[model samples]
Target: MKNYFDFILPTPVLFGPGMAERLPTELRRRGLARALVVTDRGVREAGILNPLLAGLDAAGVTCCVWDGVVSNPDADSVREGIEVAKRNRPDALVAVGGGSTLDTAKAIAGCLAAGVAEVFALREVKDPRASLPVFCLPTTSGTGSEVSYWVVITDRRTHEKVSIGDPALSPTLAVVDPLLTLSLPPRLTLWTGLDALTHAVEAFLSTAASSLSDLLVKEAITLVVKSLSCAVDVGDNLEARGDMALASLLAGAAMQHVGLGLVHAMSHQVGGFYDVHHGLANAILLPHVLKFNAPECPDKMKTLDNLVEGEGFMEWLKRLYEKYALSGEKVEIKEEDIPTMAERARANVNAQTNPRKAEVQDIMELYRKSFKVVE
Candidate 1:
């Protein structure tokens, strides 16, 4: 085991129907008092924080909320959050929202620990120094930022999404409470669920896949396959929501362990270029990239095909997009941008994990094929 592989799940998790209510107690256990809450507008406006805040109040924990986090958290957004962090001087951080909000909170915590003014500074370093304690409450079950050791922070100046991988970025504690996600509407439900599916599929296909990650990814995929449709179609169903939350967490851990593939690399470039939702771009790219990588990992693809009820893995991925109505959204991307995006994707370290080594022209072809394919 020593020479073969190393696996670590650094965060302690508290999972249940109302686990977010346990936050104040958990913070106190960590010897924390004043807290900075990093979140997005949806969590606040949807009234998801009322009960959690009431619990914090009852536990005598004070907080300052920074709810300006945007989708695809950029350097400017994180810097703004850090300013809030500096003001509050909170002893701990509570990240409450979806993937973007959770990532914002993690970067804010990392910036405070590293003594850095901008998240981009931390991005340039191989292993950032700051490792702040973070309590994560995932209102969306998609990105799995709650349990992962990596984050994608966009540089505002260039609009390029920089992927940062460091163990220091993992949350100190993760609270997966399905009740908090009851407020997640159907569109978000579809996007995030598909994102979780992509995470599982990518990790399972990664060349770095180990016996340990394979087990985790398989279970994660099973959960998504069984629960995503139920969770999307019936948002308030506690059982389905709980399964998806677990699936996202497991898929995240698996991805963090084995790394991802060309899908994330290609889609991230598009997301940065077109300002498309990360998951939406991933949903569009998953089947195409998988088809490209399938030849290199036919045995793994066959395993996945057997697990999922479909004609083939490719058909299964297509059905997932169609089933969730993910194909209808217009991409609005310029054809001229395809080559640049492909070059950027090839340069991205994420593309290295593809079972098949992706060529520059291969990615270009993929990007061109993806443009205006919806009908």
Candidate 2:
């Protein structure tokens, strides 16, 4: 037997339907009396904010809402959110929405704690000080930003999507309620599911992977393979949604230790260049990236194959994409753009952690495969 290593899940997790209703008690337990609720405008319009608001109100917590966060949250959004946090002087931050919103809240908390205005100035790994306490209520079942210590923010001036990781940014609490995700559209459900799948697969095959992380990643892969289609096809399937939530959480937990690989590295470029949805970008690139890394990690893919249905992981992924209408979605990628995107992806920090060493040629080939090739 392999020697066991220390494993820890510092963030307290609350799972199940209607679990978000307990947010008040969780915050009180942390002794946080005031909070800044950060979310996007669409989330507010979707009526997802009402339940969280009611919970905070019931807890006697004062909060100010900031709804300006956009897809691929940028430095401007972080700066504005930090300003809001300073003005409110909240004891904690509550992020309610998707990964973008959660990441925005994390940036806000980190910057406010460090007393910095430039989002890029705060070092992701160097600064040891902890950020303000953050509580996350994820409305989407992907990204796993609720539990991760990483924050992805865009530099509006340079058009670069920057990923920064620090233990300080990990949320103090994660409220994962499947009911909160019941209203997600089919397209979104598929995209986010693919992102979660990518996280699991990448982390499982990461060079830094440990036995514990491998176990979590394998479980996450199985759950995603089993439930993603049902969650997307039948939005009312609470059981499927529940499974996806668990998968996402497990994926988040896995990546916190094992990290990710090429798919995320490549997707960040798409997002930075075109402002694409993070999950959609990842979904479009997943199959091609998997194929690129297959040679280096065939054994891991074999393990994933066993989890899904034994020896055809790529085919299974393709079917899932087709089942969810994600297989035919139009992306703006062109053959000519491959060189630049590949260069950018290769430059990503996450690229270095891939178990397989990818060359520029490998990245270009992956890009060509990702290009919209209609049958």
Clashes per candidate (backbone, < 3 Å): 0, 0
What is the lDDT of every predicted structure here?
0.83, 0.84
TM-score of each: 0.95, 0.94
lDDT of 1: 0.83
Give the top-scoring candidate (lDDT).
Answer: 2
Q: Where is model 2 more than 4 Å wrong at Cα?
A: 1-6, 124-128, 334-337, 373-375
After aligning candidate 1 to the native by TM-score, how far in Å is the CA of 304 from where it should be? 0.7
Model 2 pairs whose backbones collide: none
- Give the TM-score (vs. native) of candidate 1: 0.95
Over the full model, what C-alpha lDDT does candidate 2 score relative to the true structure?
Answer: 0.84
lDDT of 2 by residue, 48-80 (tens): 888788878888988788898888988888888
